[model samples]
Target: MTHLKVGDKAPDFSALDEQGNRVSLSDYKGKKLVVFFYPKASTPGCTAEACNLNDNYQRFQSLGYEIIGVSADSAKRQANFKTKYGFQYPLLADEDKAVIEAFGVWGPKKFMGKEYDGIHRTTFIIDENAVITDVISKVKTKAHSEQILGD
Candidate 1:
């Protein structure tokens, strides 16, 4: 989970998107942003979350929120995942873990009784001024959009 909370100043960072183009938090400075950090790209859980957001992309747009998915996946892998799922949003290829660390999403994790360091699936909802408004630590992957937007 993120150490930063609501009203906290989100760290500014930059990374390559799936297309190898540079993108940064500053680009969305004057816009609402949904920056979600996931462990990897194309995995079942990740895909479910991304697709759920993609399915509701227009709804988010109408609500004035731009979404960006971040993972430590390579650019090629990110591109493949986006293409396979027909996602409308950009997926940041945080291969160097810059964004992940800046957001404090990279840390210890456990699965099947094993422990290891990894990126936690978390979402930070930032307002127009780049201040975090909501942080989703426990994401409901399939219903992620609903989790963010509510009923």
Candidate 2:
């Protein structure tokens, strides 16, 4: 559900992470970045995806990639989720959705035959120069690390 595609320049964003620390796209200059947007914190699918990335944190680190998760959850909720799961990366508490909308990941979604507006689960792999190298719209939560690292 993202309008962004491979080779598109990643939209710039400056938002607060779980700890209320300011995070911005500029912070990751000269580094490969994985920005994964999830529907909610602590949900089944989101948990699996976040944990999968956490489990492979070292791999990403060794390969010079930094991971960040984004959701519309409150800072408290994001902090709780991170602490509970021991995630090694930052989880953006984008309650304002500035980053979400900038990336175009929020839109109509369906579940259990019900339709509503929500954040679409998506991952964008960006190279050091800020160009998107890949956009994983159909995320495989259980194998997300492989999806990003499967060169």
Candidate 3:
């Protein structure tokens, strides 16, 4: 599947959030969304990115945006990550990779000369109408939320 681009309808998906609640993209309709995909739950870079989002969460809320993080981790792990990092947003469990595949963030990646398939750190900003407004495929962990907010 091709990666989603700006102006395209953001693919709708439903997944179990950290709290075991069923959350769907359509549920957030009429509201802007920042949907981010990360590689793992508790890794350094992922944690940093999530924390940055947590820190700027109020700013995002003030801008009328809801933020969600997606990863291949289980709901339990996601809950732990959120609790450990004090993240105020929902972290969706994409153990089946359905949501990740739909967003085209699940793919092969190389690290330290090793090739593996995983979630590529990426973020998508969707407008209230569900049209994608911006995509950040190459994310810098520490500045992720800032970049998204800027866009």
Q: Write the per-residue lDDT of candidate 2 for residues 44-126, one digit (tens) a residue.
A: 99999999999999999999999999999999999999999999999999999999999999999899999999999999999
Worst 10 residues of 2 by lDDT: 1-10
RMSD (Cα, Å) of model 2: 0.7
Model 3, 1-151: lDDT tens digits are 2368999999989999998899998899899999999999999999999998999999999999999999999999999999988998999998999999999987788999999988888899999999999999888899987698774
Residue 44, model 2, lDDT = 97
Candidate 1 regions with alpha-carbon error over 4 angstroms: none
lDDT of 1 by residue, 1-151 (tens): 5789999998998999999889988999789999999888888999899999999999999999999999999999999999999999999999899999999999999999999999999999999999999999999999999989987
lDDT of 3 at 88: 89
Worst 10 residues of 3 by lDDT: 1-10
TM-score of predicted model 2? 0.98
Q: Which of the predicted structures, 1 or 3, would earn the higher TM-score when compared with the native?
A: 1
Model 3 segments beyond 4 Å from truth? none
Error of 1 at 64 (Å): 0.6
**Model 1 reaches what TM-score against the true structure?**
0.98
How much is 29 displaced in model 3, in angstroms?
0.9
- The Cα local distance difference test for each model comes to 0.93, 0.97, 0.91
